[model samples]
Target: MGSCIICGTDVGSGRVCDSHQEDVVFDFRGDSPNGLVPSRFYRGVVDGYAEFGVFVDLVPGVTGLLHRSELDRRLDTLDWEPGDEVFVQVKGVRDNGNVDLGWSIRQAEREFRGVLVQEPAGEHRPDEEPSDDGDDGDTEAETETDESADDDIEVADSVGDGESVDSVGDGESADGDAVEADADPEPTDKDVATDNEESAEVDATLASDGDEDSAVAVNGESDGAADEEVDTDADEETDADRERAPITTLGDAIGESIRIEGEVVGVRQTGGPTVFEVSDETGAVDVAAFVEPGVRAYPDVEVGDAVRVDGEVESHRGDVQVESDGLVLLDGEAAEAVRRRIAEALTDEARPEGLQPLGGDETVAALADDLLDAAEAVRRAVLESRPIVVRHPATADGYVAGAAVERAVLPLIRDEHAKSDAEYHYFTRRPLDEPVYGMDAATNDATRMLQDRDRHDEKLPLFLLVGAGSTTESADGIDLLSVYGVDAVVVDAAVADPETRDAVDTLVSPELADVDGDEGLSTGALVASLASAINDEVRPDLRHLPGASYWTDAPDRYVDLARDAGYDAERVAELREAVALEAYYQSYQDKRELIADLLFSDGGNLAAHVSEQFREKLETEIETADANVATEAVDGVEFALLDTDGYTHRYDFPPTPLLLDDLHRRHADGEPFATVGVGTDELYVRTTADVSVRDVAARAAEIAPTADIDTAGVREGKIEFLSGERDAVEDAVVAAVAEAF
Candidate 1:
């Protein structure tokens, strides 16, 4: 008898009980298919290929065919090779004893939770005696030489009627429920322990390199390069080489020989050259090293090593790159000198010279320190050649914040990098379904960045969170980036919690600056000021963005600024409507060119056309919602309740929030009224009075303590509660609004 490792259930001489066996993945230790359990996962290696399918070896003699029909995608696109390891699931044992294998999407070991070692039954335990058949003795003798047994399976180059085979011995049949008596002898306890240890080590090795599709080549091809760097006799020559060549910035030396010093961030192999991505504080450029065709030159060089290079500047494919004539690794005083020089340049160049917020609003002016810090982080990312990923909510205000940053940073990226498409390569703007950075968004971002770094040798991205990622809800997403040493800059106009301050490298918000009436300041306003600090030359173009973000009543300063910039109230409304319409479709794409034209162009043809549609659709939805609102008194407070799902066009351009905003504005009739747009399980509360949605949600919870109410979408004044307790939550919210009034 034996006990299961997971649940401690007594089993009849096996590692796990039959009930818990399928729950854990097993490493098949035996050499035959008779020992493998059906419907189980196993690690296998690609043995060879055939036109019809790929041959996979689970153990030494156990082989199966992964047919082209079972593949999730086209087989021709697979990157697997003969020696690459993959994961597979056993479908069934056929009547002819051939094992049918199923395709697995998770090819890496990290995707599996646990791995157990499986052993044959009734061979070593005291409770179960070994079989006395002479066939068992012969099976053991055959496996001794089975290491070369797979050589007989010829690999066919084209599709033909090739019969698949399994390792089931003569004593086992397709329907055998128990272990066959002629199976190989069971491994000893010590042997099992050793196998488990070895498996663990292999799994750890694979997991450590899981960020890449394959392993990284840290050790370069050349053997004598390390010796050359460490030679004691070369010290004087190295010092003289550093002194002979004058150091120059990559941006300044376009077509001349210049000596530059920086850290090597990435190393990639090309067909004829080894490209080393070198980054100084000023900018990053590719430095090509040529020892011979397809030979890596610097054998000793690795990522994170500081080096000094004397190279001739040349442009490759319209992008500036360096052709290395002489390169040497720096150490001791030389390395420190490079580090200090880069640090000084980062501090000087990260923020714009003589930086100030775009407008003279004192509330925003008070946040200049944090605004400059945020801009500096973004600028540093640009200089370091890291991608900037902007995540914003799918709203007009959110798009405004995201677009402002995109407008300011795109020009700077173009001016700084020699690559013409650097703007597209380095910047991406994604819209969130809601204004919260949860696990799903974080996992997606991390996966993309990791894959980009692994597959293309791209640097990690700088995540710029606009309109979202400020509350405590976003901590998990931010922490995920911190694990990879990626920095996030959070620019929110909401009253963020203090805990968020600790999560991000830079937190820019009016509440953090102790500004009262901070709710009036939108994310667009904050990011507009920040965008100017990033690039002051784009200041004039971003004047209309802040006003466009305010749907109902814009602050007079931004309104007057837009007017002075030739965007009157009607023209500003046109741009606002045009942007709002574009924000709905393809929310994932930034629509950079179209947005730039709408917001920055002096001519109003595009804005006038799109805004005419926006105004028509929005006014129709408002009139429809205004007819459906029912007035009632809750705790003597006037309440206008509208069924948003029934009254508003759910799929229309002007979304529910904008529709509700216009409905309340045009039909309120001068009453201190609270408008509640109730959906199936969510409620949106908008009032002319200054009432806190967070406070109302708290009070609703107090009124119905068992309703399990939550203040979801707090920035939009939305609440989510149990649909069964809809009446109680509505009554409590109305009462809370009365008290606030």
Candidate 2:
């Protein structure tokens, strides 16, 4: 009458069949508490306590508080992980068993909580022999733990995941992860029939009875021929049913570059570790493997189902791993997905240095910082004269950005083209829109406006754009040159991304629009008296001008001249210094001569070289001169002069008033404020109160009543107005004067 959990048979009531009362179960880990906080799992973690110790349950409703004490041992270090499985046995009781469970791990190796396996009896009947499978054929086992699969042993034809290492009872089929704990069927007739009703127990003295060749003698006498054949067949089937261990060396899976084919034995979730046991034609190993992102970026293989990994294998910590350089996918859908993964991985590699991507763990603000910095840098560089030719562009943020680049860059270019005065000065490779460039526009337009450059005497740049594409791209806006109209369009030369910022940048090209118009001069009554200038007035003649350089050189040259004079003093004292100074100047003069000669001769090679060398030298000299100028005093007027309204004088003096007399002389006599009234022969002093004596009073704008300022408008007194309308002029001037004050 023994019905116990250990053997699942009836034992006589009251006494435990297999229990040893002397051993105490000390490891009484109960179910974990309701508040047990489990940490999220990931790779590379050492299972640290990023949190407090949690209570892990071993039995229902009873939790054991996992503490550092769990690692108490002679080793002195708690290096083992909570997930690592170890077997320990209970040896004795502790502290009167009052909640303190002390156990001896050394005594209970097989008696601990694990699969309880029943051992075969010592004695057997005369004809009894266990079946070949060593256990019931239908019985299956499942694992609650993992095993090292590196260089894992592969079955001759195949292998399954999580197979048990040791055989259980006879006739037991191979164990696998799919071997449900309940996969074993109820007592089959085979098992029931094998357990004889003839299993009559004798007295205790008879327990040691049956032994020695009784089975051989009984079978040999009854069926000698038949028994021999049966034994042979049984032996072969038993051999086939034997299970192989599943751990092996990583080296066996790989060698140079041959493909290893096997059916897919494992399929981890995508984006997770790719694991499977691959077998060769004969045997195989369970491989623990992964592809690095660089390999992932360009992977050419399918995983999971079936794969032939044509890669190198390596041993990482005695674990076998497939070191794949690349993969080839045999399946259709899997192949596409692998390619996409590779593409994604590749794109990640191409991100600019120092730019970080948005990892899942990153905060929103951090991502914002990256994006903001990229946009601002590009924008700031372009405006600050140190623009860079970067692939990534500023966002389509139409904020108030500063650039002297014209508000109407297209119309201005068109007008310049009509007058045959447009000349695009090329500044290739470097980015800066300086005064010499005629227009303050992006080099994006420099190409298209090439045809308009006054190449009659000047050589224009023949830009050969280079980049990732084949043929010239369609010139959206940037032309080749003003004179050349548009240079060749090159596509793929510029990197394209899904971001539309490049689109915004491309817009810069079209700002150099086609201009074909007639020449017209500005003419008006007020302009007629001034310098017989263009439009017959005091207007500036700037149509054919090369921009501010024409105006700035007069000032810059004086500084250069002063430099020579200062250096001349030093040179005069030392002949060596004089020679060196002379040589430098002569070299510069010679280089300038070369450039001039090249320009005049139109010698392609000589001109390009001299131009390049001159620019380089000029830039260096300019920088050195700047350092020197930092110490020099500017030549602002000393005792300047006065602008007199014929009566009063206002003196203009240098910023530094080193000499006071220089200021006094400027206000002396009518030499400074001489005024004799023209109409009234009266000599009056011009003071702030003498409104009548002011020049603007004498030139109080007079206009036709028939024509309104609206009809012929311009700015007045720093405001815009037209001579025909008095009211408009008064309003505009009043506004301007108020603003100026």
Best by TM-score: 1
lDDT for each candidate structure: 0.69, 0.24
- Model 1 worst lDDT window (10 residues): 197-206
**Model 1 Cα shift for residue 454 (angstroms):** 3.8
lDDT of 1 by residue, 172-252 (tens): 233633322223333321101111111110000001111222212232223322111212334335434443232335545
Give the local distance difference test score of model 1: 0.69
User: Which regions in candidate 2 have their CA more than 4 angstroms from the true location?
Assistant: 1-53, 57-63, 69-93, 96-169, 172-741
- Candidate 2 TM-score, C-alpha based: 0.17
**Per-residue lDDT over 1-741 for candidate 2, one digit per residue giving the tens place of the 0 to 100 score:** 222222223334311224422221222222322222122110111222323332332334432333434332322123335443332322222333311112222221222211222113111112233235433221212110101110121211111122222322311233422222223323321101112111111100000012211111111011111111122344335433433222223344444333444433222221212334343322334332332101111122222333434345554333345543222233444334433443453343223233221111122122333333333333222211121221110000000010111111212222212111121211122211110111222355464333333321122332221121111122232322334432221111112223222322222111121222111111111011111111111122211111111111212322333234332222211221122222233221212222223222332444344335534443443333223221111122111222122212112111111011222322234222211111111111121111222232223233223322221101011111233453444433222222222
Give residue 163's lDDT in candidate 1 (0 to 100).
Answer: 19
All candidates: CA RMSD (Å) = 17.1, 33.5
Name the TM-score of candidate 1: 0.65
